[model samples]
Target: MKNKIKLCILLLFSLSISAQKSNKPSTFERYLQTKELVNVQLIDSSIRADLKYATTDNFAKTILYDTLFNIYAHPVAAEKLAKAQKYLKELNPELSLLVYDAVRPLSVQKKMYKVVQNTKYAAYVANPSRTGLHNYGMAIDLTICDNKGQPLDMGTSFDFFGRAAGINKEAELVAEGILTKQQVKNRNLLRKVMTRAGFLTIRGEWWHFNAVSLSEAKRLYKIIE
Candidate 1:
């Protein structure tokens, strides 16, 4: 009976060790919290510099826009962003990632009004109507730039919500010269960038992408920050 008891205790200890291993922080998580890369620029640098106080739920502080209204998840988001950036760089060296939004600090909601003013897409921009992937800091919306850093015209502006924004249709129109070819080329380039990053485009928006591995994104990130 004593020998049986000892075996049972050993079994329990083994299970405990396994559980501990499973719960340990991930390498991505550690790297997210510590390592910083020179090539990966924070698109929100101006927002972070401007606010200087707000932080995302995930602890990524605001850099450009008012985080009081839009807090961002920490640079932990840098992992996926880096992956996306790599794809963008390859597609067109001139195109880089610029975060239109990230974490929202409740305090900045008042200031947010000014930012969204008179914009056709303001409703989508102002509040978290749905769980913004940006809230998770796992999503990015970017535009392409020219050698001079000027944004090329995609069929619609970055957050445009209209029929003209249809990716496939616009691609065809641009091909036919119904729309300026550069606009179509720009859209195709953006699509290629997301595809290379392992992302698939949704039917609705040219500017948005869900990381290819939706489950992985959910597992790797939380919504708060």
Candidate 2:
């Protein structure tokens, strides 16, 4: 009877330590590992992730991810993310890459679609029927931040849909007095590191990037459902 009580006490102690260590719920990390995705922090602990969609602060104005907080991505994307962080650190050790979103699941994609569909934001949000690069863990939405983890002014906020958020006409936008040259410079710095890291930028969202082309993503991996 004493041995059983001692064993029970030991089990409780182990559980307490486990609870402290596994900050993320089991299902969360399981999904990440099941998809064969890498936690960004595991690659580069200094790489920060805000996961805007995890909260209600995003464009959708809903809690898309109530449980998920940590950032995860395909190995290819994760490696490139680390490279971007390294490059940024090389350029200015004070700066870090701040991730907004990564490895969006199909369920979350559907929710994102519902919020944007029939609105002007529709074109920007990927339709669930046709999975986005993020679903394959092959894309990232991030920005540059200071050592304090505060993001630089990249003109508009993340998930901002409109001419202000578009990178295609930054020069014209700057000339129009819509976006400042300093803002353009900041955006350019972000582009420099990410492009150097081999991520492709889209004409629409400056924060969004693809680790590989859509063709490569579709051919190489399955979407996270």
Candidate 3:
């Protein structure tokens, strides 16, 4: 019947239009959608995320990312993070990893660098031109939280740009009574779990960890725009 054929054609055309609209993501949506990145929450919901850059609580005192954009990490890094979470549970079932920042865009990195450029904190933030592991989605800033979801004291808070936050200064601080023995113990525990899961820490930051060397990350991965 001609009427039946016309109805079927109209339905097909409508479905095709819907498909085209769905395929064309907005600029912001495309920015958040990357094949190389994985939503950490989707992989392991138990690992908590605060996402500092999404809020104005960061050192810059400005919101860097859209809050709707979920925390993301390179697939390799996400797997390692999942392993780290499992390791943390094995160490103490009540403890969990809390992510502060992960998979930062280069645009955000430049903003962070500008804020600390001329200050004493310049060394704490990496130069965007050099493109650090975080720019490549291979780094994470995180800390451990206890059963009650309270972050463990690491002698210094996240994004603390001082010698006290340096991993190498833990012993010195503990000796000077600036850092408690328990704080050092907590930092060590975090380091242990992350290292065992194939993440490496930098001497200058206790909260920062790289899933791969900076060179390796730059060579193998595309920097998230």
Candidate 4:
């Protein structure tokens, strides 16, 4: 009877140790371990980050992210960004990529949709139901900055939600004098570097780019929440 009682105590102690180990934090238990998302800053500190969604300065006019800092992306996407940063440095040592948004959670997407839904701008913000590339950590909203960390004017500001912000409208805007040739050149420079690094730009937003297709993102990764 005493042996059986001692065995029961040992079993309980083993289970307790197992639980403690499971709860213990390890060096590998980092944001990168999330499988689909990797903290870009962890991989490359040179990349500038603004993260407008983390502040009320965005089109939503509200803070969307739970944390006030840190940008995350799919490992594949982050690798391409690192390459793009390297290319940018080669082209102009003073220039660096500044990120505005990355790896938006589905909860934040719902917040964005709530504000733009039923409006003409609704098309710019993807519906939460279908889940966009950003929800899967595969999209980025970014721009280029100089050594002083000042963003180069890309014709229209990020999240302008107008025809002026469209990549397709650059020529028309330049011809109309609304956007100078220099501004278009700056935008194209950003595109050149990003495309060289395997990112695809969207038609309506100059600041937006996808590391992978929507179909591929949906098929290959789970949405971040």
List lDDT for all candidates, in order: 0.51, 0.88, 0.84, 0.84
Candidate 3 local lDDT, 1-225, one digit each (tens): 999999999998776557434544434435656556777777887998888887788887877775334568899899999999999999899999999988888888898888877777787777888788887789999999988889998989998877888888788888888889999999999999999999999998999999999888777778887
Instruction: State the lDDT of candidate 4 residue by residue for 35-103, as single tens digits.
Output: 557778779889999889877888777777634356678999999999999999999999999999988
- After TM-score superposition, what is the CA distance of residue 78 in candidate 4 from its true location, in Å? 0.2
Instruction: Write the residue-wise lDDT of candidate 2 on 164-187 in tens digits.
Output: 999999999999999999999999
TM-score of 1: 0.53
* TM-score leader: 2
Runs in model 4 deviating more than 4 A are 1-35, 116-123
Ranking by TM-score: 2, 3, 4, 1
Q: Which candidate is the best by lDDT?
A: 2
Model 2: which ten-residue window has the lowest total lDDT? 17-26
TM-score each candidate.
Answer: 0.53, 0.87, 0.83, 0.82
Q: Every model's Cα RMSD, please?
A: 17.0, 6.2, 9.8, 11.0
List candidate 3 segments past 4 Å from native.
1-30, 116-123
lDDT value, candidate 2, whole model: 0.88
The C-alpha local distance difference test score for the whole of candidate 3 amounts to: 0.84
lDDT of 1 by residue, 69-185 (tens): 222343545455566667766666666654454433232443444455676545645464344454455554555565555666776765456666777677666666666877777
lDDT of 1 at 189: 79
